[model samples]
Target chain A: MPYIDIQNDLPGIRGLMAFSPHTAEPMGLLANALLHHSDGLLAAERELIAAHVSYLNDCFYCQHSHAEIACYYLDGDRQLVDQVRTGDDQAAISPKLKALLRVAAKVQQGGKAVQPADIELSRKEGATDKEIHDTVLIAAAFCMFNRYVDGLGATTPADLGSYPPRAKQVAENGYGPHIFSTSQPAGPSVKPL
Target chain B: MAHIDLPDLPGIRGLMAFSPETAGPLNELAEILLRDNANSLTRGERELIATYVSALNDCFFCSNVHGAMAGHYLQCDMEGIDRIKGDFASADIPAKLKSLLRIAGSVQKGGKYVTISQITDARTLGATDREIHDTVLIAAAFCMFNRYVDGLGTQAPPDRQYYINRASQRAAEGYLDFELYKYK
Candidate 1:
């Protein structure tokens, strides 16, 4: 059970967002700006960054759900999801993305943890100035988001399989509507028990 | 010196300038989180939470920036803010804020570090759900911000008054309009 009665059955950050639409609207916009709106980085690459940071933070709901979304963008490449989770640098990704991921990892540890060397590596791999800026911000944002979801003990769907369809919806429509979910799916019509 | 070729603007502002796209919504979020008075927690209290978390992360620019804002809203001087940063537990402030700060402190370490008892204790001390929710979110957001500022190795003005002098202007303007502050 979440520490606060979010008054909904939505899982993870979605539940928390529903509880506070004031924050939700802006937050959803931020997510869209970073992930959906094109600022040079591919949607899949950006989502991969979000998913990988969530994976580092050990937020199951975020990691799998975002991976599912990234998978959608990647034409169902589950292997990238696997490699990103394991922080496998050699995992068949563009060298630029791999370098950015390394920088993201440093941001995940702590802010000061990201050394000049990390930025150097990203630049050497041909990452743009904007990519480096977004990479750090994306990593930082996920750290905030991961804490928001977990600190309140938001619901994590027991069924990990449930994330893909929702990921599809998000990948297609973007994040705003989901955060302000008006249509709560009716409870399980067929009880598992 | 920032690792990236950001303009010489100080702190998070420079980073925001480098990426105006992300900065738009981020500034909106900051306004809602720190300045919106509809929630029970005062702007001062929320700003303090933001400040303390930045201090904990050792991000001098953010700590001082929001610390100045906290002082501006709360009407306490920098010495009081310094005391709160030193150890909020011992600060001369409300028990409710202390409780919330304890929860904020736990969050500064890691999300999992915030125990159930801390939440319950905060609730017991008259913290509404929104307050608890806001506190956690503020802490989380600052972690994001602290990383964004420090991760790029942005420089802070070594003089503390650089922030304090600007607090009045910033607190009046809220978070959305970086243009008004001429931070660009």
Candidate 2:
């Protein structure tokens, strides 16, 4: 149960957002820009970075949900998603992605944990400066998202079946629409200051 | 002198030079988070949250700059601020702020590490839901800010006065006014 009386059924940050729509707006906008935007980095790769960070943080809802999204972008390669989540070094992905994942891992540990050599390695692997920068931001932002979800004691769906459909919806429509959609019954609307 | 050739930049600005696109929104987010009055947390308390997380992350520049801002807002001397950073529990501060700092520490570690008891303790000590919410966001945001500064190996000034001066300017002028580098 959440520390506060949020909707019992709404999973992860969705319930928390419903509880505090004020903060949710900006948070959702940030997510849309970071994960869904058509930037230099592909959406799948960005979702992979998010999933990897959530995996490092052991945020079950984030890791699983983003992995589903990543799989969708990667042609339904859930095995690759699992591999990246567990250990990207052993995962069969491009060296550039592997290097970026390394950078993301360092961000997960702490900012200072990332060293100059790491950036150099990523660059050597054909990672652009933009890709490297986005990787760091995605990793850093997920730290906030992961914490916000778990920190508020938001519910994590026990059923794996629940995530893929939601992931499809998010992949198609982005985060803004679903953030305020009341189709799913939420808890009493409270002001999230 | 950062990993990237950011001429004369120091602290977080140096790292942000690598990607100006993200920096715009991030700076906007900081302005709203630190200076906005939407929440009841005093700017001093919010700065203390940032400083405490920086200290935990061992980011010298963030700790010093934000610590100075925190001291400025709280009317605290350097010694008092240092004491709080070193050990907020025993520091001479209000019980409520101390409890909130404890929660911030947990956030710096990992979100899951924040236990229910801590939340309950903070509530018992009169920290409102907004205060708790803000504390978590501040701690979480600083983790990103600290990483962005140190991840790219930005240089920190050896002279503590650098941060003290910067703090006064930031407190007065605010974060939005900084002319950040555009690397597009």
User: Which stretches in model 2 have alpha-carbon errors above 4 Å?
Assistant: A5-9, A182-193, B5-7, B181-184
Please identify model 1 stretches exceeding 4 Å from their true place: A182-193, B178-184
Model 2 lDDT tens row, B76-135: 866778899998888878899998899889988888888999999999999987788778
For residues B1-184, could you state the per-residue lDDT of candidate 1 as single tens digits?
7888987788888887777777888888899989987888999999999999999999999999999999999999888998998988878889999999999998887778889999999999999999999999999999999999999889889999899999998888788865823753
Top candidate, metric TM-score? 1
True-contact fraction per candidate equals 0.88, 0.48
Measured against the true two-chain complex, the DockQ scores of the candidates, in the order shown, are 0.87, 0.56
Q: What are the lDDT scores of the predictions, listed in order? A: 0.87, 0.80
Residues forming the 10-long window of minimal summed lDDT in candidate 1 chain B: B175-184
